[model samples]
Target chain A: MDVLLVEDDYYLADDTRRVLAAAGANVAGPYARVAESLSRVAQGRVDCGVLDINLGEGPSFIMARALKQRDVPFVFATGYGREVLPDDFNEVELLEKPVDPRLLIDAVARACRKHETSEV
Target chain B: MATLAGAMNGPGADRLSALPWEQTPLGPRAGWPGSLRAAIDLMLGAGAPCALFIGPQLVQMHNLAFDALYRDGSAATRALGRSLKRDDPDSSLAKAAGEVFAGRSILLASQGWTIGASPGTPAFNLSCAPIRDESGQVGAMLVLAFPVTSPARLDAGASISELQHRVRNLLAVVRSLVARSAESSDTVEDLAAHLDGRIAAVARVQGVLLRNPHAGVDLEGMIRDELLTQSADQDRLNLGGPEIVLPPKAADLMTLAIHELATNATKFGALSQASGKLDITWKLDQAGARGQQLELVWMELGVAIASQAPRRQGFGTNLLKRRLPYELSGEADIEFRPGGVVCRIAFPLAPVAAMGSSSVWGVTTTAGDDA
Candidate 1:
C-alpha cells in the first residue's frame, strides 16, 4: 500500500514514516506544507494521506479538499482540539497527536477500506 | 489633626497608662541634647508627641493614655532604663512611669490632663513600660507617647461620602470627551464610526461593568446585543446560541472584538452591500478533562469582495489575532471568501472564576453566582 504523509513537523513525519514502513506500507515523501503535499497527490496516485489540521499559514483543509477531489482517503491530526475544525470536514476521521504506530496503521486500513467501498 | 497628635503626646502619663490602645509620644525632653526648644519645635512640627529623656538619670515616664495606647512600644523601649520598684509616686514623673510600667495597655480621654514637672495641662498621650537588663532584671522603664488633632482640624481629607460625587464628575468628563470627538461628523455612518472610536477609547480591553439589576450577565445574550447595536438593518444579521455567563473582562473584550467585526462588515464587507447577511453562532465543547472551549462561528454571504485573503493586519485583525487570543486564552481566524469574511474564535472557558465579577454594558446576562 502506498501512502502520502502530509505533515509540517519533520520529527513527527520521520517517526510516522518509520512506523508505517515497518508495518509493510510503501509511503511516499512526507511533504511539509499544503502546496507541496497536494502537488504530490496531483502527480501520482496514493492510497491514503495524513494531514496536520493547521499548517504554517492556516488550516490544511485545502489539502483535504484536494485529497477528496483525487478520490484519496485521509484523516486529520491536530494539536488544536477537534472543536477548532470547521463543520464541513466533520465526516472525515480525526486522529489526535502524538500518533501511535498501531492507531496510524488501523486508521490507514480503515481509510483504504472506505475508499475501496466507495469506489464500488 | 494637630490637636489629636498633641493630646496623644502631652503629659498625664499616669492617666494615659489606663488606656487600652497603642500610643507613643515625643516632646522637647525626648529630643534633648538638641535644644529643648528645638525638641518642642520638632514635636510640634510633626503635630505628635515625642519620647522624652530627662537629665542623666533618663527616668522613664509617660502619660496614662499614651502608656495604655502604646504599651508595646513602652515595654520594648523600657529595657534601656533603670527599674523603679515603687508604685505611682507623688512625683508627677514617677507617677507617669508607674502608670506605664504597671500594665500592658491603656486608653485616653479626649480631654486629658498633661504630664511634666510643672504639671501643665498640655494635651498629650503618654505610655511606658519596664525595661530589663542583661540579667533579666527590671532595668529603667521607657515611655511612648503622641498627640492627635480633632477631625475638624484637617483641611484636606475627603470623606468616604464624597465617592458618589466624584463618580458623577467622571461621568461628566466622559460625556464631554465623547461629544468633543463627534463634533465634526454629520452623516449617520460617520457618526457611528466616531461613536465606535469613542467607545473603543474607554472600551476597556475587557467587557463593560453593566448596571445589571440581577448583577450577572448571560454572555451569549450580551454578545448578541453588542453585535446588534452596531449591526446594519435587521434583515442582514442572524444570531444563535444557548446562554452562557461570562465575567466582566471576558464579556467586555469579546463584545468589543465582535463589535469590531460587525463594524468591519458594515463598512467594507457583507453588511455594506445590499443582500449581504451574517450568521453568528456558538457552542461549548470539553477539550479534555481539564479544559473547556467556546467555539464561535461567523458566516457571511452576498457581499462582494475582491480579495480572497487580508494582505495586512488591521486593528480588527490585531484584536482578533493578538488581544483576544492572548487576553482571553482564545484563538481566532478570519478568512476572506468571495462571499464575505468568515471568522471563528475559540477560547478556554476555565479561569473565569479568577477574572472576578465582570459585567458588559448594554447587554443582559446571568450566572450561577445568583441563580
Candidate 2:
C-alpha cells in the first residue's frame, strides 16, 4: 500500500512514518506543509493519505482536497474531534491520537478500500 | 423605579416571594412542581452566582451573585416567565437557556454576565447543567456563573474547543517525546534521565504560562530557571537583554532548546570546568511587517570545540537546526569555534496578549477563579 502522510511536527511525522513502514506499507512524502504535499499529489500515484488537521500555518483541508481530486481516500489523524472539520468533509474517517497502530493501519486499509469500491 | 423598590424589599429569596407567582407560566408558588421548587430553592440559597431556567418557556430566577445582572429591576421583573430568547436572541443567557431546554448541557463564556455592581458588563465563565424532575426528565437547567473576570477569560479567542485542541496536541507531543527520547539514548538509564529532563523542561514552561498568563513568560526568568535547575554557578553566567515575553507558542520549544544548550554547557562547556564562562545575550530588533525579532547569542568560552561537540544527530542538535526554524519560522546557527560553541537564534515575536489576560485596562482578573 502507498500512503501519503502530512504533518508539520517533526517527531510526529517521523514517528508515524516509522509505524507505517514497519507495517510493510510504502509511505510517500510525510510532507510537513500543505504546499509541499500539493506538488507531490500532482506527481500522481497515491493510494491513500493520512493528514493532521491543523498545520503550523492552517488546517490541512487543502491537502485533503488535493487527495480527493485524485479519487484517493484519506483519514484525518488529528488532536481534535469531528467538529473541527468542515461540513464538506463529513465522509472522511477520523482517528484521534495517539491512535493505536493497529487502528491506524485498519483505518488506512478502509480508506484504500473506499477507493477500490468506488471504482465499481 | 417601582421594580427597584420591589427588588429592594429584602434579599433575593424575599424579592422572589414578593413576585405574583400565580400570574406566571410556572403558576402559583404553592402549586409549583417538586423539580421546579427544588431548582428555585437551590438558586435562591446558593452563595455563588446562579440562574435557574424552568420549563420549555424559560422562566427565570437567580441568586445574589447575579444581583448585578438584575440591578435594573424593570428589565428583571418584566423578563420573568418569558423566554430568555424573546428579546436577547444573541445573548449567552438566551443561548444557554435554549440549549438547556433542548437537553444539552454546555459551558459558555458569558460576555454579558455582570460582576458585582460593577459599572460595565464584564465577561463570565458559565456552566449549564440539566436539573431532573421527579419523573427523571430534564425539567430545568441550572446556569452557574463561575467567578472568572473578563481579563482572565482565556476564552476570548481560546474557546473551550481551542483549549481541547491544545491539550490534545500537548498529549501527542508528549507521546512523541517519549519515543524519540528512547531512540537517542544508548542505555535505559540514559533514556529515563533524558526523558525526565525533557519533560521537566516542558513542564517548567507550562507552569509559568499557566500562573501568570496575563504576564507572558519572561525570557530571562525562563533562562535563569533552566540554568538554576541544572545548578549552574550564577556568577560565571551572564544573562542580558530587555524583558521579553515569549509568545506562548514559542515558549515551549524555546525552553527545550535552552534546556539542551544548558545541558551541553553543564557537561562539556562552562559549567563543567573552573576556567569556563558562558555569555547569553539577546537584542530585540524591528523586523518590518513581521513585527519584532528576538536575536539571541549563546557563546561559551574556555571549552575545547572539537572534542566537546555532541553527536550531530542528538535531539538538541536536530531541534536547534531543524525544528526551531520550521516551528517558529525563525533562524538558528550553531558554530563550533575555538573559544566554544556559539549558537545564534532569532525569531519574530507574536503577541501573547491574544492568548488571555485582559490586563490591558490596568485591572487583573477577579480573584474568584471559578473556572
Candidate 3:
C-alpha cells in the first residue's frame, strides 16, 4: 500500500518518510500543510496516510475527514501524544512520536493488512 | 550675662538680634510688636520655652533647653540660622526638634523634615531650633514642617527592575521561537519568513519595553541582521548601515518589516530568481528631536521578479500591511521595477538616552553576490 505522510516539521518529516519507504510501502509525500496533502488524496494518489495533529493550525482533522469520505484508512502520528487524538478518532491506531523505525514498519504493515481485510 | 550686655551694645550685635519674627508679636499676650527685651524676658520667665531665629545671618543660642535638645551641633545650629540638610536629617531633627519645639525634656519628633550638615535625607518632615542673639532676646521662632512620604519613591525602583527582567525573558523567548520556526521552514524562503516574523515579534515586545521610557533597542543593525539571516544563501547577501538605537517597538517592527521585504525577494522577488542580488542600506537623520528617522532601502538586482507573482500580494503584502503597521509604527513601500524589487521603510527615532542608554547611528552597506 502506498502511504501519504503529512507533517509540518521538515526534518522529522524527511526522516520518517525515508524510514516508511524503507518499510516497503510506497510513500507519496510528507506535505507541510493539510490543504496541500488533502488535494493529493483527492486525486487518488494515496492508499493510506499518517497525520500529524498540528500542521500550523490546531489539528489535521480536516484532512482526516477528507480521507474518511474516500474510504481510505490512516494512522495518527504526533509528538503531542495520544491526547492530541481527536474525539472522533477513538478507534484509530496512533503512533506516538520518537517512534522506532522497526516499530513504525510493523505498524504500517498491520494497518495495511487491516485495511485489506476490512475491504474484504 | 555682663558679657551678653556688652555684646548687645557692640557694633553688628543689633543686626544679629533683629530677625523676621522681631517685626511681629512674639505672642498674642504681649499685644503687637513688643520690644526684643520684653519678648526675651517673658520667654525667660516661662523657662524660655522654645526660641527660634529667622534671619539671613547665623543664629545664636544660649538656652540650656535648646542645647540639651541637640545630641550634637547645638553650637553649629546657633551659628547657621538654617540647620544643615543632610545625613539622616529626619531621625536626628525629629528626636531633637520634638523636645525644643514642644518646650519639654523629651526627644524631638519631626517625622519628615530633613535637617543636616549635607544634602540631607530627602522627604523631611519637621525642623526646630532655639533662637538667641547678643541681647539674649529670643523672638519669634523658626519651624520647618513638611510631609515626606512619596509613593513613587516607594515602588519606582522595583517596578523598573522587574520590567527590565521581563523584557530580557521576552527576548529569550523570541530567540527560541525564531530557532523553532526556522527549523520548521523548508527552503531559504520559508526559513527567512519564519525568522523575520519571529524577530519582528521580539521587536514588538521590545518596543513595548522601550515605550516605557525605560528600555530602547537598536533598529538599523537589528533590521540588517534579521534580514541577512533570513536570506537562504546567507553568504550571497551583503549588508551595510550605521546602527541607531530606536524606540523599542520601532526596532521590533522596522526590522521585521524590512525583513519581510527581503524574505519575499528571496522567495519570489529579486533574491529568489537566478543571478539575484540584494543591497541593504540605512542612515540616521536628525529632522527634529522627536523626528529622528531611520531610513532603509532594500535594492535587488539580476533577479527576474516577473517570473514570480508580479502583481498578486501574498506573504509580502500581508507582512507590509498588517505586520509593519502593527509592529513598527511605520510605513513601507515595495516596488517591483524592471530590474528588481526595491523596498523602503522609514519611521521616527525614539530617544534612547532617556532610557539611560546610547545607540549609535550610521550607514552600513552589504551586497549579496549570488551567482
- Tell me the TM-score of each prediction against the true structure: 0.34, 0.63, 0.34
lDDT of 1 at A38: 64
Arrange candidates by DockQ, descending: 2, 3, 1
lDDT of 1 by residue, A1-120 (tens): 888887654445656778789999888867665556767887889988877764322333777777887888888765444554567667677766655678888988898898788889
Q: Give stretches of model 3 more than 4 Å off.
A: A1-120, B1-215, B231-235, B285-290, B310-319, B322-329, B350-371
Error of 1 at B317 (Å): 0.9
RMSD of 2: 12.1
Residue-level lDDT tens digits of model 2 in B1-371: 53433232224776677778677677766666666766777777777778787777667778766654554656555555565545555666666676776678898865545322233333567899989888888888898876566444523333454556667777888998998788788999989989999999998998887776546578999999999999999888988999887856678888999999898888778788777789999999999987778999998988755445666578888887777776666888998777688999998775433333334324332221112
C-alpha lDDT of residue B173 in model 3:
41
DockQ of each: 0.01, 0.16, 0.01
What lDDT score is found at residue B348 in candidate 1?
69
**CAPRI docking class of candidate 2:** incorrect
For model 1, the DockQ equals 0.01
Give the C-alpha lDDT of model 3. 0.53
The TM-scores that each candidate's chain B achieves against the reference are 0.43, 0.59, 0.41
Q: Is candidate 2 or candidate 3 better by DockQ?
A: 2
What docking class should model 1 receive? incorrect
User: How do the residues A4-119 of candidate 3 rate in per-residue lDDT, one tens digit apiece?
Assistant: 98865444566678888777778877676655676788777677888765543233477777777787778877644455455777767876665556777777677777878988
Give the C-alpha miss distance for residue B214 in model 3, angstroms: 5.5
**CAPRI grade, predicted model 3:** incorrect
**Against the true structure, candidate 2 has what lDDT?**
0.75
